[model samples]
Target: MKRFVILIFIISLLFTGCWDKREINQLAFVQGLGIERGKDDMIHLIVQILKPGLLAAGGGGAGGTGGGSAVGKPYAVFQASGVDFAKAFANLNDELPRSLFMQYNEIIFLEEKFARSGIYKTLDFMTRNPEFRRTAYILVVTGGSLQELFDLPNTKQLERYPYKEVLGMIENQKNTSSSYVCDLNEFLEMLEIPKEAPITGRLEIVKKDGKAIGVRMAGSAVFNNDKLVGFLEEQDTKAIMTLKNKLRRSTLTLDKGLKGEKVHISFVVIKAHTDIIPKVKGKDIFFDIKINIETHMNEQESKYDLTEPKNLEKLQLLINDKIKQGIEHALFVLQKKYNADVVGFINILHQKNPKLWKEVEKDWDKIYPEVKFNVTVKSIVRRTGLSSKPIQPR
Candidate 1:
């Protein structure tokens, strides 16, 4: 009986042997992944591979933070091409000595041309792959391709970690621009709804003295389904953020006072909320948007006394008009010009009243452009900043 027990233990040990386990050191860890179309009209996949040896040597800058981003040119670049994204993404295996480890990949950039052509194919592999994280930042390169952007040098950067830089861009702007850092999962979820369009962060290389120095997060890239339609400018993007109920903090620069001597007052939005109310008028569709915003006067160029209740009330009215105008402008550009509904109004209808959505889901696109919107803003001045009134000239 004792011999039988010993034999059973030995058999269990034999079955427990690792058949598919991969060692971290033996794998070629990827830092960033870039996809674009090549001259051959095929998909090109670019990967920034991290060297474990150099990483083990110990380094400062972004490397110390312990992410997959490359420090300087210490990382290797691998380019592979094929007919489809799946084939191109897999072709890198033949070029690298170690197994391609995308589990560490931090960012993915797609050229504007390819993104406009339709990123459905590239997204398929990334989403379906169990190794890839859904949290990786995804951006559309508008100004230049990954090669050109990565080749640039940045002095402000602790090291040339493009992934870290892009991540930092969203991190630093957390207080100013609502959380606009979009990931692959969020984008995929948005694409599932035909009534909603997905927009990703826009990336552009900054050039000075005829040289690319660094990269900047350029607003956002709007997509009509899988194709790139247009972009939301700074103010337009802010308006959308407000409507999405994600505007954590932002300042509104309003031109008030006399026409001949107009003054710009920057109102810091302390709190904001938006409610979308859809109305079905016979066969026509209309929307009633209600916005409530609370702000504090941050900076002023006029002699307006923000401490005064009467003056504050007047200022609130001006802010109301401004907010309404901004929202209207964004709606015009998105609905009239692009015909893209990134606002998710249709989904709102479905959620609020599915029966109604079923009736107009087919013709929502046709009704979208023709649909009229009524925007109403109610604003309040919560507090006066350090000063009660504007700084008078000495």
Candidate 2:
């Protein structure tokens, strides 16, 4: 009987609930975080805290809207400043009654000014902190106030949080291929690579009468090490994504001369592939880039039937030219204009030809500009949409 009681007591200890469990009511859930430079060289931190009470009220199909946003704001934004991120966070925590919970944070916004100044310290702090979430998507805020971005009224009817709207925007990149998105982990990994620069989605403010009305994620912010070097516009961003093989799906439009008249042709790119081969001829180094694309004819404004083999072949050639031009433009900007290698050129050489990489690793910066690229593109229009040819005007 004594042994049985001791065994039972020891088993009960194993079933003890979480030792440091925190009640939901005692924690403030942070949905998003924004960092920027402040006056007197202080670190400015902005946090978006979820309002549980409002969320609860918005539930149960409120107002026949089926769980839409509440009448009032579902989140609140707060800002604090200090000499460093840790102190800034401590100051912010003092203003709230509940402890800040950041494990659920979905987004991290770095203001343009702060990114330009340098993001190494901020990134280091985040990586070192156990509470910070490394999976959070990182964005560079431009042409707006970080606070306003967090506090802006939700335009999406079903979204209860501003960050969710941003998430949807980021998700659209899979189809649009107009912007670049990078999470904390991916950005850090890029930074650690040699001769490879880091980039993040560009979040720009849209305003009405000098007040921020909304935000748009278009283009990308390029970086050299941890500092901002420049930006890639939407077209350039698309080209870069294509070269990097990150473009999942995209639409392209071209005006081609058909039957002695110019007509518009739209295509939906369903598949794309890019290959880069590094070669060394004596002391000179160069690369061969081949881009293969498969697209479907989406729209035709003319009466001509482009599905015919000859016409289709001509259309494919035009598409190949257009894609080639875009890729060349992107290469010119990345190599000649910025001199930043964000396209992973060094990685290819290192993986394929380590011996050559070792010899040029010391003076890659000087050698990269002179490195020529031989580009070839092959595009095919696989299928035409419902209407093979446009209706006659007759």
Candidate 3:
């Protein structure tokens, strides 16, 4: 009985301390959206620091309809500039009462000029900061100022900030490869690899009624060692996603025999697997890529007889062709044009045949462009909803 009483007292003592406790009202909560720009060759930081009271009040009412009005009168938006990012952040301390915290920061936007100038310096601070999360997405503004991107108003169904809205869009879309979140850790990993290149998300603002409506992700910014080498269009990004097996649910529109007519097909990927085989034939090296994809048909624009085996074969061929084309295009762009292998093919090669990779590690970049690849894609369409037939009358 005495021992039990002592154990209860010990448990009670554990709950009595406030050693690291912080009051909610005392600390500032940052939503984790920031924009960096360059002016006069110096760095400028613009942070979208959230106002808790305003956010709470906005969500208090029914239908969550108070975001625009509340955000219009923001709790605080600040900009600071300095030679270094840390110095700039310190400068901000003078302007605000609370410390600049980045625990919840989700997105980082860089102006085109700033990105083109170079992002390595700015990225150093992000990676080194203990308060920052490695999962925060990094983006490049295609053709706008950092302020413009940050100032874009929230116009979403759920009354959230424009920054949060952009993050939500990327999270919600599966067809779009550019929407995949890229953080500092992934970016740094890509940089460390000599053969692999890194890609950052792109954002562009859309204005309506002279007010910022929203910002959309354009594509991806391909980088060759902290330098902006080029950009991958949306189509190219899709191809990259297909090769990397990162696609979730996407629609592919193809010309299905009817000369002028187009067929739209949506697929929900059930399972996807990829295998890379590296072959060394004396002086030549070849890569054999085999991908197995299983999907359920979500939509079909035109009528197709799935019951007939012959028609189903044709549909299978069409899917294979489309997937093949996408892979080929992605490889061409990554190897011939960009000269950067963002798909981690070298890692696969090393895994498959470590002995061969060790010998050719030094010349992998030169060899990568010369290496021939044979890609084979197999797609299985399992089901075509309840009513497989076309809804429109024949």
Candidate 4:
């Protein structure tokens, strides 16, 4: 009996209530962050915090209708400055009533000036901090005020939260295939590799009538390690995504020469893949990119019987040529213009020919600009859509 009582007493002692637990109301949850360079050699930090009460109140009562008008903005914005990223983040507490929490942070925006100056400080802070989630997306703000981006009014009525709207813009990349996005984890991983450079999706303020109304996400910011080197235009960005096998779906519109006239045709890409092969001849090196694409005819402007075997072959050839041109242009910009290997050429070389990679690794920067590239594209039009030919005038 005595042993049973002692054991029961010991078990009871283990039932202590929630220690080191913080109440939700006492912590401010950050939705997004913007980093920029400030005056006086300080770093500026902007944060968007979610207001739970306001959001809950904004949600309609029983049916999805009324309370949205009564509630003010569902989030608040705050800014601060410090000598370093860590100190700048810490300084937010001075203006905040609750402890700032970052577990829910979804996106991070780096101002162009800050990124150009070098993002090593910001990258260092993010990598060392356990509070920041690795999956949160990172972007570079180009040619705009970071504060204005944060202050964008949710006028579109498409999304209630400003951060959600911006996040949705990044998500749109999968459909448009004109931009590229990467999370903090991916960016950090690329930074760790000497041969690989890091790139982030580009963000800019959308204005109409000279007033900032929303934000736009397009193109990409190319970086040589932690410093922003240049920006890739939308077309180049799309080509890079295709070459890297990151494109899910996209539409290509090209003017085709048919019957001594030009006809516009649109192809909806269904599936696409690229094979990069590295060739070595003695000491000379070359890369061959073989791109295979599967697409469907979406639109045809003129009454060209494309269903015919000969016409279909010509259409496929045109598509192949168009894709080849895009890939070539992208390569020209990356190699000849920027001299930055944002593509996975290093990875291909390391995997396919590690021995050769070792010999040329040191001179990759100098040789990359002069490296020759051969591109071959093949496209198949699997479906002609509902009608094989354009409808004739009745």
Candidate 5:
């Protein structure tokens, strides 16, 4: 037995081979990837690679400032065109001295046009490749091209890390309070299901002073199966987020119960639970959504005294109404206009009442639009923060 154990250990030691090993200088770490379908009917691939010099500079602190500033373009962008994804990736590698490593890639930006056409090929290539991680975040670029978004001087260049910058924007769960950060795995999983849709973050420029300043994560790109269908505005996505219990923090603007002024209040979500009560009467089916949210006030811009029980109760009712409005708007756009089930109602049915779902699976699209939604939102304001009223009015 001791000889057998020694033999197994020796075999395991031999399994570690130097054949696949690569040195640091021989491998290039890809931070971001952008894919777009060109007008010439080919795939345009763009990649952002990290440089060792900038990392060295960042690692050495203030003392390593010498000659590091001259190492221009902290990350380099390489573009290539090919007949298909595999060819495009190979062409990208042809342009680089070292192999383009993709395991560390954080973000993949797909053009709206490309995503709308279909993503089966791209997704297949990404998933089949051993080097690409399934967890990488995917964003759909809108209002502009992928190259234009990448060409900006400040983006993925100069001193900042673009991967971290954009990834940070999506990962900042509390600050966003509204954006959908959909990963490749989550998207793939959605594609495998029937009567369900996938949603991703929208990368676009925010206008300032009648001019475009910089790109920000805004809205959501809705997908029905593998093709892009439509986009949900910030307000609509917030409603979906609320239903999914993914609302981290939000600034709710209540236009009621304040007598005159609209109340602008920010709050951190303590807990949000949603229950989809599927109603079935004969062959007719609809959904009743129950959203229970607990939040404490962070900042309030209304003159209502949150300390008073009556006023606070009224404020909570108003908030509940606003939340309902948002949910209705989202349901209208998704179920009526787009007829996409990005809210996972189909999965809810499958989990809760699988027998009914099997019968209704074939005609979910037609059934979904006609389905009625009863959004019941109950919200409470637990804290009033430092001030009970707005600092504006005396």
Candidate 6:
């Protein structure tokens, strides 16, 4: 029994040893930033790999200390191309001894041309890769190369790129409802459904002094079957946010009967709700969307009496009109200009009235351009900031 126990202890020690061992110092830490493109019918991969040592040193300073981003030869931005994504990555491995690791990858940028060609193939690689995170943010770059995106200046002190900085800003903004950070799984799920259109973050390089300077989230890219269909500008994106009940705290400027003077009102979204009702009459599908929004004034530019019911009524009407117009324009652009149903209105109709959807499912896109949509926006301005009256005296 003593001999058996000794043998068993030896076996346990052997099993405890790591069979697949890797040193953190030898591995490259990827900080969620990459760009994907196509050239000569092959996949092009550009990775913005993070430098851990520099990141550590920079973060070690005072919490808010700043000194023009850590100056270490820390990050290595590289590019490679091949017939398949894996092969391209494998080719990259030939250059560096350490394997290409993407566990911390945060954002995926797809060029417009490549997106129009079809993203399913590239997305397949990302989704199937065991090491890739399912929640990495996805963006569509307009009229720029993967190299251009990588060349943007690093203004943050933590050795971060513009892509990460912009996304951080959007996440930290007061209005967080409509502005969501989409990942591989979320985008793929939305694309798989036939009735829904997928939206992705849009990026563009802003140049200054003959150099790539900054990055901006221009708007949202509306997709149809993984193809580039169209984009919703800033205003349209905001409108979609309102309809989707995603607005956090946004300002609405209104013309208050004064020529060349407008009232800038900041409001925090208190409550938001949306309802869709479908009606069919002789092959015509009519959708009525009712949106109820409640807000508190964060600021009022002009002097106005808040206690007056009449003024409040006018303010409510103006808010409703602005929201309605924004929605109407977005829908029109989606239907006529892009021929894409990005708002998932068709899906809503199908869910609410499946029978009608079944009948029109086959020809929904063809009929979408002609479908009549009625939108009703109801807004209630519940509070007028800390002071009941505007600071500017009447």
User: Which candidate should be chosen as best, given lDDT against the real structure?
Assistant: 2
Ranking by TM-score: 4, 1, 2, 5, 6, 3
lDDT of 2 by residue, 1-394 (tens): 9999999999999899998788978888888899999999899999988776754565522112235345566677888999988899999999988889999887999998889999898889889987898889999999888987887866633566778778889998879887899899999999998888898799998888888878888799999889998899988898888888988999998876455368788899999999999988888888999999999988887777765678778778889988989988888888888778888898889999999999888788888878888899999888898767768877
Give TM per candidate: 0.91, 0.91, 0.84, 0.92, 0.88, 0.86
Candidate 6: tens digits of C-alpha lDDT, residues 1-394: 9999999999999889688677765666665445465667887777766555565666422112343355743466877788877788777767775666777676777877777778887778777778788887788877567687776655622434544565565575435443434678888888987867788777776776656766666778888888878788877877776665566666665655222356566666677787778887786788888988888877767676778888788778878887788889988888899888776777888889888788878888798889888999899998886677756645
For residues 1-394, write the lDDT of model 5, one tens digit per residue: 9999999999999998797877877887888899999868899898887776665566422112223443555677789999888899999999889988888887899999999988899899988898998889999988776766665656433235556667767867455566787889988998888879988888885545644445778888999888999898898988888887777776666554456565566666677778888878777787889998887777665566666788887778877887888889899999877889998888888888989989888988888888888789898777667777657644
Candidate 3: regions farther than 4 A off: 1-26, 52-71, 154-158, 175-178, 207-212, 258-268, 391-394
Error of 4 at 117 (Å): 1.4
Better of 2 and 6 by lDDT: 2
Q: Which whole-number lDDT from 0 to 100 does residue 6 have in model 4?
A: 96
Report per-prediction Cα RMSD to one decimal: 3.2, 3.4, 5.6, 3.3, 4.4, 4.0
Clashing pairs in 1: none
Local accuracy of candidate 1 as per-residue lDDT tens digits, 1-394: 9999999999999889688899866788788888898887899888877666567665422244444344546566789999988888678877778888877776888888888889897788888888888988888886667787666564656555667677777776556773355788888998999778888777877767866777777678899998888888777887888888878888888887523267888888979999998888787778889999999878877887767778777888889999999999989999989998888999988888789889888887787888789899999888778778777788
> Where does model 4 exceed 4 Å of error?
1-19, 55-70
Per-residue accuracy of model 4 over 1-394 as CA lDDT, tens digit each: 9999999999988886777678877888888898999998799999988766754565632112234644566677999999999899889877898988888898988998899899888888888988899999999987578888877776654666677777777877788886788999998988887778888799877788877887787699898878899888888888998888988988898786555367788888989999999998777788999999999888888787877889888888888988899889988988877788888698789999999999888989988888888899999999999988779999
TM-score winner: 4
Clashing pairs in 5: none
> Which stretch of 10 consecutive residues in model 4 shows the poorest summed lDDT?
60-69
- Which of candidates 3 and 5 is the stronger one according to lDDT? 5
Name model 2 segments beyond 4 Å from true: 1-19, 55-71, 155-158, 258-261
Q: Model 5 misses residue 283 by how many Å?
A: 2.3
Q: Tell me model 1's lDDT, rounded to 2 decimals.
A: 0.80
> How many residue pairs clash in each candidate at the backbone level?
0, 0, 1, 0, 0, 5
